[model samples]
Target: MNAPAGISTLDRVKIFSEITIKTFDILVIGGGIMGAGIALDAASRGLRVLLVEKQDFAAGTSSRSTKLIHGGLRYLKNFELGLVRTVARERKVLNRNAPHLVMPEPMLIPILKNASYGYWATKAGLTLYDLLGNVETPERHRMLDKTQTLAQEPLLNPEKLQGAGCFVEYRTDDGRLTMEVLKTAHTFGATCLNYCELRHFTYNEEKRITGAALQDKLTGKNYQIKATCVINATGPWSAKIMQQDQPEKLPELVHTKGVHLVVPFEKFPLKQAVYFDIPGGRMLFAIPRQGVTYFGTTDTPFTGNLEKPRVEKEDVAYLLAEVNKMFTGLDLKPGDVISSWAGVRVLLYEAGKKPSEISRKDEIFISASGLITVAGGKLTGYRKLAEQVVNKALEKYFPENRQPSGTAKIKLSGGDFENAAAVKGFLKSCQEIGQLHKYPSESLAYLVRNYGTNTKAVLKEACRLKAENLDPETRLLQAEICYTIQNEGVTSLSDFLIRRTGKLYFERGQIIAILPAVKAAFQKILTLGNGILANQESEFMEQFEAAVAFKNESKNAMVSA
Candidate 1:
């Protein structure tokens, strides 16, 4: 890999070698959003950091989110002003600092008979939500009468519809945002490794936490790493990590399973995001995204293994039944679904409360043995939570030294994308160039959006390789797949399709069908032998098939049986 233009790869072999010599200021476990943010914070502030992910970044709860960067307007219904304000403020920071990915959007909260929140209450909450965000962005809330509301969202259930309140917020590609965070952390020199398993830990004689043992999933090689401080951001696996050090250091982790079902854009094609309550009091979101629509999610408590979660028949039936009620024409059956996925959210150890009622507010715990654990927050506020945790680590490490602050203002890799006119001028110049003129003009717009300021490198790389006969599965190019392997740390087809590109999440069928070509591209650039490539492809296809089988099995399985 050529380091992906501006981003840097940590060279896991080198990081592990030094760590085996018991060298590192910090050891970070679970490289999801929280850990990634903390690693960037610590690295930028001059702490030698190593972050290990048991799987790929954002492969778990982070990717399974509703994919919104908005403040929790629902929390305002419960009068949780502090949490609402906290997340709302974060929305502003992310929008400005990561503008290429995060953007403003309006949400429609349809009011109806026997709704949990009536029109009056919803309006009050939206007003407070706007106040909390403090107008960092132009979009805000507006009240819509029945006819006007129905016009705004034609698919919405208008039968006795008391009207709607439109409020502004943010949405993003969750996986992309997570990757950008990790990439930015790498830019600041945080050593990161995916598919690295934490075997155990090392402790000082005085019972201070020292380091850990890690196994590389690629080569199955094991290594030991020592650190002055250890932070666990393992999400659902937090309990597993803690019990490795002390049997009773922390309580057991509670797992909550959520499922998202993707459908065709024509099915709903909502103009704005909708937050409608299902029967009883639970709420489900119908969000329009990237030429498709998805509705979810059931927050059912689970005791199943966290390694993999299977979407149950009851969850699908419940979601469909609920949405069908709000929208009479939906009538969405199992076959209408394009794709579905289930993920487990690790809730804090609790006695009797249901997972749905569990708070999304994050908690930080420092044990007697000096291990820090962060758990239970949404995607919008991960960076803020990390800012708090890193401040603690720095005060403990440097005592009197100063550290750089203001991560909220720090621009991410592609956030500095030039203004629209500059982009248009560049495109005009590219059109005039003889070498670039032959490239597909239609794809120029999509290329600019996906690659951001890095389009220059991709186009330049395309010119350099001059690999003709490009075979792209969807919007992405086969050459771009090669570039991803040669530059981005894409080891498997899954990483490239699902994370590096949105093909899997957006068009999973093409990903399953084009495995051979994707692997061929991988082989061409990485020079991977057939045996290694074959094994990887087979497992990915099996996983994909298993996912399909899971969906079919749910359709056949009984909800109560």
Candidate 2:
């Protein structure tokens, strides 16, 4: 595949050869947010770095988050103030750096008569939250009376609605955020490859860790890459990676599954995002994104396949029941769910505590063999976690000198806007460019918001693609697919639909309609044979069906792709 100029991993044949021949200061396993952040931090500070993911970047838990760069208001109840403070501060940093990816949005928390946090408690909590987060006045928490709350979001059950508390929370596309971070790392000289699996560890005479043997899943070839340090940043699969080195080590991670369901906006017409209470004092979020509304996150102990977490009949029923109970007379049913996603949270194991009660604070563990493993962190705190990992490696091994982290102010790729206001103006300009090519305004707006400064390249691709015998929608999809394949290291259809663009979860109908064009693009761009194309198409359909399959059908629809 022909990658955009300056992207290192666009040429996999070259990258594979480089991985085998060159030695790196740090080798990061897992290409999710943590590993990507670590790669960015280490590479930026002038370290030779190599990062490899068995799946596509953000294919795991990183892309499946609630997609909020929040301050962890619920953590306040657990008295995890430090965690909240750190993540709260990170929210601001991310919004400033990746303004196009992460933006501030108002979150409404209704105070009910029998709510988990009452009027006074909610007020005190939000006040403290603002102080802790250093929230600005305009976006600070505002106490809304019943009338005001109803006017803002009339979906709330009026029987016990005491009031509401509106505060700022950052919304983002988790997968895109991860990709941008990794791309920045690549620019800073990090060699990254997806579908590369770590086979085993190699050691010297002292029996200490030296390097790892990796198998390229794409080519079915094996290579040994030498590194001074190896860090395991795989979220749910962290323990599995650790045990490969020390088979006798006990489990340190507890896997908890969280499920989110998406329904059409008309079915559940929510004006704004809501954080409402459910049974057992738990809370669920109903956020409107694009054109659909998604609500989720049922946390429960999980012991299933880590690659693909199934959304069972009970999972759908639980969310629908809770959402319907919290809102007015809108009796939602299982069939109303357009699509859904389930991700496992790899948390630190705590004795005698429920899944939701476990602390979200991340912890680092170093084995005697010199393996570094990071576990149990929220998406908001990835940068800090990466800094800690890199600092630890430098201080312990390279005691002679250490490079201070410089990623605090580094702008991610495609996030070159000066501020949020500048982003809006860029969008308008992009709309004009798309209109000149006879493209729809909404499609161009979506592209600009997601691709940021890279929208120019996409628009150019759309122009070039006009020669092809394709519809407007197919041409647009092909353009976006071409760009991701060239720049984002997209190898499979699932990577483009699920992780790169989020079309599988948000726009299932369009995927079904445009899949023929998508498959054709992949086949031509990647030069895939008929067998490979068929296999990839089958795998993509399994995932597409799995997203909407509910009840007994869900079990049959479960796939390990």
- Score candidate 1 by TM-score against the native: 0.91
Model 1 agreement with the true structure over 1-561: per-residue lDDT tens digits: 113433322355565566576577888898778888888788878788888888877787777777789787766655668888899989878877666577777888898877677888888877878888786445778888889988888887777488998877788877778777777777777777888889888888998888888898877999878888899998888877777777676865678898887778887667778888766446788888767788888888888867667766677778878777777577887767777777788766666666666666778877777788888877898888998888777777556647766677666655563444555565555545423336666455545555555556666666655546453222236556655554455678777766666665567766656766677767876678989888877766665664545566765665646
Candidate 2 regions with alpha-carbon error over 4 angstroms: 1-10, 552-561
Give each model a TM-score.
0.91, 0.96
Can you write out model 2's per-residue Cα lDDT over 1-561, one digit (the tens) per residue? 012323423589888887878889899999999999999999988889999999889999988988888888988888899998999989988988889999997999999886668989999999999999888888889999999999999999989898999999999999999998988898888988899999999998887799999999988999998999999999999999999887787466799999999999899988999987677646799999988999989999999999999998888989999998889977998788888999999988889989989999899988888999999899999999999999998887766657799888988877888899999999998877777777888998788778888887877787888898677767888988889888888999999999989998889868877888999989888888999999998999999888877844644555532
Write down the worst ten-residue block by lDDT for model 2: 1-10
Local lDDT at 113 for model 1? 73
Candidate 1 residues lying further than 4 Å off, grouped into runs, are 1-15, 18-22, 349-352, 418-448, 467-476, 554-561
Q: Which has the greatest lDDT?
A: 2
Clashing pairs in 1: none
**What would the C-alpha RMSD of candidate 2 be, to one decimal place?**
3.0
